[model samples]
Target: MTHTLVQDEAAIRALFTSLVEGMRERSPARVVARYADDAVTFTLAPPLLNAGLDARDPEAVAGWMAGFDGPITIEHRDLSVAVSGDLAFVHGLRRLAAVPVGYPEGFSMWTRITVGLARRDGQWLITHEHQSVPFYMDGSFLAATDLEP
Candidate 1:
């Protein structure tokens, strides 16, 4: 790897760090700010896919954030980042744990995460993101979140 690659990797890592911080803060706006205007996300939510943060109501994102209460802790492992000029991508396994403030405790699970970023005007912004949990192919469909990296 060259010096530029090292720098790119550092920058991308910083971006993910910021994302984790934002989640810990429990501020949807803060987290959404890290995404590009045209950002697309495939998360653990319904509707399957979301496109353009600006196109959706801010409350939509806030509602999702509001589902979680207390401090949100996330751990990323097996991280791999690649960069080529203004384009970059990072993929890893993420474990998230949080409890709902007013409700019963929630379950903690690990999911696969991949985020695509673009350097726009010297700043790295997430352009696309996907989070998934593999499922068993047997007769019963079950998430394989119990697996560890």
Candidate 2:
């Protein structure tokens, strides 16, 4: 592998790890810091499409974290990252587990995530993020939340 490829891979890996850590800390600001100022996202929540920097507002993250009583843990598996020049993308399965404050002691979710990054100057910043779960296509548009990766 080329030196640039290795460095790019490491940079993307660090960004991914930082996202997990930020989520665990329940700090949306920290998580959003990995993105570019004009970043866009397709989140798993309702109104899935989020555009512009406001899309990464800490409030959105806070709303999601509010459901969990205990600390939440996030893990990504089967990750694959590719970089070419100043652009890169990463895709993987993400697992999020937590105990809702008012719900069952154990609750978990599995979803797919893809991130697009752009190298500006000497830094790599996420420009796009898409996260989603499959849904039933037979009449009912029910999300497959019970499934595991």
Q: What RMSD value applies to candidate 2?
A: 2.3
Please, what are the lDDT tens digits per residue for candidate 1 over residues 1-149?
Answer: 33488887888888788778877887677677778889888887777888985424467867777777877887788899989889998999999888866778776889999989998888889899999999988967998877777
What does candidate 2's lDDT look like per residue over 80-143, in tens digits? 9999998998999999888888886786889999989998877889899899899988889998
Best by lDDT: 2
* Candidate 1 segments exceeding 4 Å error: 1-3, 54-58, 101-103
| C-alpha lDDT of candidate 1 relative to the true structure | 0.82
lDDT scores of the candidates, listed in order = 0.82, 0.86
